[model samples]
Target: MPVKIRLQRHGKKGKPFYWIVAADVRAKRDGRYLEKLGVYNPNTNPATIELNLDGAVDWLQNGAQPTDTARAILSYKGAMYKNHLIGGIRKGALTQEQADEKFNAWVAQKEGQVQGKVQSLAEAQAAAEAKAFEAEKAVNEARIAANAPVVEDAVEDAGETPASEEE
Candidate 1:
């Protein structure tokens, strides 16, 4: 029985959520599955993934092939790297402690990159808003200046018209 790791569609139209599952390779795209391993939500700013790491590793070792998108998700979460490290451990190329240390360092670096991106986005949005406010303020000042002389002229004209009629 060939098993596959894939996403099962959920959520409403447009906004999508997915279940990562272990299913028979022959099953339909969103059909029945053997086990629900986790969930994925792409609507969030940074795509969200919830997974059972041990279960996922076990499935991969047992030859459960992943779909392209699922593979990317697994790669992002470091499942693929963990698998590689285990392989290295099995082959005596590296110790488990060394593999864990490398994995932790990689995860920390990835998280820092994500944080930097989020901060940059926030700063850009704030700058755009400040620029827009300054432009609006300038427009208001121009309009006020343009109307001031016209208001003064009207008042002076009204006074002269009454005095000329009296003379």
Candidate 2:
């Protein structure tokens, strides 16, 4: 049977999520699968992928064809790179240790990049919130000042006050 790697659509119609799976080529998009490889969540600022690296590489080595979207998601998550490294190891151009080292380095760099993006986004949000708070405070202070009550001095009756003697 021809095996294919593809995404099975789930979640709401407008907000979709998917399961990455290994299934018969003829199976329905959301039908039964041989094995689930991962999940993809596209709703995030940066798309999120949770994949089983070893299983993916194994399937690739076994000649399971990946659909276009699945291929892109795998590439984004470095599964393709890992497969290439495995191929290099098989070809004797590189040692397994070397391949592992490269993969680890790449993972570390990717993690750093992702973390940096998240930090920057958080910082921007915080700055915006602070600015809004300050603007609101200023407006409130202005409103209070504008609506301040006026105080007037009371006048005494002319008959009640003692008159000064004329020289």
lDDT of 1 at 5: 94
Candidate 2 pairs with clashing backbones: none
Residue 69 alpha-carbon offset, candidate 2, angstroms: 2.0
| C-alpha positional error of residue 14 in candidate 1 after TM-score superposition, expressed in Å | 1.4
- Candidate 1 structure quality by residue, lDDT tens digits, 38-149: 9999998777899887788889988999999989988888888888899999999999899999999999998899899889888998999999999999999999999999
Q: Mind sharing the TM-score for model 2?
A: 0.83
- Report the Cα lDDT for candidate 2: 0.90
Clashes of 1: 0
Off by over 4 Å in 1: 139-152, 159-167
